[model samples]
Target: IDGEQINLSIWDTAGQEEYDRLRTLSYPGTDVFMFCFSVVKPDSFDNLRDKWLPEIRQHCPEAILMLVGCKNDLRFTLFNKFQNQERKFVTSDEGEYMAAVLGAHGYFEVPSFHHSKVAPIFHEGAREALRRRR
Candidate 1:
């Protein structure tokens, strides 16, 4: 992006149990793995440790892993309007700690509609991929 054009191809795996075996087929050439979870959905974050991390490690141990907390806007909205609601939203501290525990290269929070916020995550992933090549 800094005066250079990078071509990136992304493969999004289905979260369905039926696709679990098929997902590993695309792991071989993956440059970076963006393990994303919604801040508003605590179960998705739990899956990172319970499901995704083990699968990724088994298939692509050398891949650069980045942990992303999505739906930041939802979390903020809920916080402002319904602070006492019995809902769980992930905090930046929790994301950072999990990233550390999972050996992720970085942790980021991104709102769904904020395209600008997502760019740096991919940029970092691409940079890490390139750095690993060297």
Candidate 2:
């Protein structure tokens, strides 16, 4: 995505039921996926895995799903409510763990504090994964 042009399909799955049929269509050929949530939201890694992840795995068995906790500006919100007090930066530990279970490559995080920083992380991660696969 830097100087080269590569076709990338990034799907934002709606939690709504209406998209259930459509979601199945994307199950295949999904090399990587980024599941994003706001850091300010009252959720933790375990909670996220329980509520949202199983369905994603069911749909995209081949896709590497990356759990991304976004919004870097909400430190107080993250610590105060979510109780992920030690989560100051992003890591792919959870991502890789899930990936291992699901036969995927791995996972990572991106702070949505600035679009500029977040954009490259996704593109670069995807590109690198693709390269390694080849």
Q: What tens-digit string does per-residue lDDT give for candidate 1 at 35-131?
A: 9899988999999999999999999999899999998889888887888777778899999999999999999999989889998899999988887
Off by over 4 Å in 2: 1-4, 44-47, 77-113
- The TM-scores of all predictions, comma-separated, are 0.92, 0.63
- Residues 38-122, candidate 2: write the lDDT tens digits: 5445355544566556776677655566656666456555567767555543334544565466444444454555677677658
Best by lDDT: 1
Error of 1 at 106 (Å): 0.3
lDDT of 2: 0.60
